[model samples]
Target: MVAIDPEPLLAAGRLAHEQLMNDACTITRVGPPTLTRGTSVLTPGASTTLYSGACRVKPQRIPRNEQASERLTVVARYEVALPFSSVATDDLQVGDTVTITASGDTRLVGQKFAVMAVDFGSHSTAWRLTVEGAT
Candidate 1:
């Protein structure tokens, strides 16, 4: 019996996955201390670009209003997937915002989504992020 090496197969799978992540998405970290203004006051943190690369973004279902008096609002929820090499699990937080742009058009840019959940796949295969519209 002969054992075949699996390196080539894994490489091919990684290549194919990368090709599908053609869309661009930026993950910005907004929670780190920037400067100290006074003895006890710390200035608001600045937006730091954590990850910027190709990703797959899909719009999740919007919740339906149950009552007529309640104003119906579309809460844009999205599932974003990116190569595991692009970002570390600890790099993203719940309040981080992911801005997505389509085909270099600003008009079609989706709403800024706040990170609700971060799913870091085992073995670092990928990162699946569940995000919702920032209120």
Candidate 2:
């Protein structure tokens, strides 16, 4: 198994927060829910249904301060994962970019962003995103 140092990890995390404030774009995208999965079972002679809702877009948030500390208050939340999926069980990485395709009549067609604070998902794969790029 690969091993990583605790010191560098903390440093990188702190750095990400700091880097976010300088040139980061925090955006919030809301998407509709879709059927992510389905299961069926028959007991006796009855059937039942179940439904789960997921977020469909990636939301980004950058720190408001360049000198913000990694002490909870200095951090923000973002939805970086495909809402069409389940919960995220991985941590975010550095230098990861996700391209978002906007669907609307607006001028925004093709836009790409760099994830800075995934805080609670596998890289840029979460219910939200905290990116630091121009929209």
Candidate 3:
């Protein structure tokens, strides 16, 4: 039996998958915070733009009781998926932030989320990120 290279298949799959990623998001890597005197300051290092382009953002299905009391609580979590060509995986780290710059759903625009985890696979079409909403 002859062997078939998976590169072509992967490429085609990514192309088709990326089309569904209609949302536009900007991923920014934030530096660690510093402390002045006895108080901790949130003066993170110079923010860097890691990735900014088409992506998919979806809220994870969780129990209602797990959510906060308020409807628009900052504790909400979401999963973000971006095309592989759009970002270098190494540039994305935990604590980085993702902001929805544009989306067909107006409600998603301007929302910010902190990266909690990164998920990728050999056969994956897009990189998945678990993020929590910020206030």
Candidate 4:
């Protein structure tokens, strides 16, 4: 009986994933918000950049619209994939924010998203993040 090593396969997968990513993204860990008069204020204390590099951003779902009176709200969901070695698996949190600094699609650039979930596994070639934002 022989045991085959999986490192080579994993390395190849990582390389392929990196080559497909055409966008630049930045992940930021935001500081705790301040509470004032029983309300949470979004005044950011300090932020740390967890990762900044090439990434792939894909639309998870079509933008949905909700109308209230004369105001309309549109919500968009996206999935971001980063190279396996882009950042440590434990460094990203659910509440962390991802900003797409540059992308081949002009509409995607300068868009910010709130991280809703992080997906990773031993065999994962890239880190997948589910994010949502108002379009």
* Winning candidate number (lDDT): 4
lDDT of 4 by residue, 1-135 (tens): 999999999999999999999999999997876657566555656898999989999999998998989989898999999988864546788989899999999998899999999986889889999999886
Q: What are the per-residue Cα lDDT tens digits for candidate 1 across 1-135?
A: 999887677667667777777678888986667665567676777888878777877767674433346655556677888875663545687888888865344542665788998886434445789988733
lDDT of each: 0.71, 0.39, 0.83, 0.89
**Candidate 3 Cα misplacement greater than 4 A, ranges:** 34-42, 63-74
Query: How big is the positional error of residue 67 in model 4, measured in Å on the Cα after superposition?
Result: 4.1
Candidate 2, superposed: residue stretches over 4 Å from native:
1-81, 84-92, 121-126
Ranking by TM-score: 4, 3, 1, 2
Task: List CA RMSD, all candidates.
Answer: 4.4, 17.7, 3.3, 3.0
Report the C-alpha lDDT of model 2 over 43-125, residue by residue, as the tens digit: 33222211122223323455453443654334333444433133332333444554444433233234545556545533332
* Candidate 1 accuracy as lDDT: 0.71
Tens-place lDDT digits, model 3, residues 9-122 = 999999998999999999998666676756655565778888888999988855233346655543677889999777465568888889999999999999988899988688
Best of the two (1, 3) by TM-score: 3
Clashing residue pairs, backbone N/CA/C < 3 A, model 1: none
**Candidate 3: clashing pairs of residues:** none
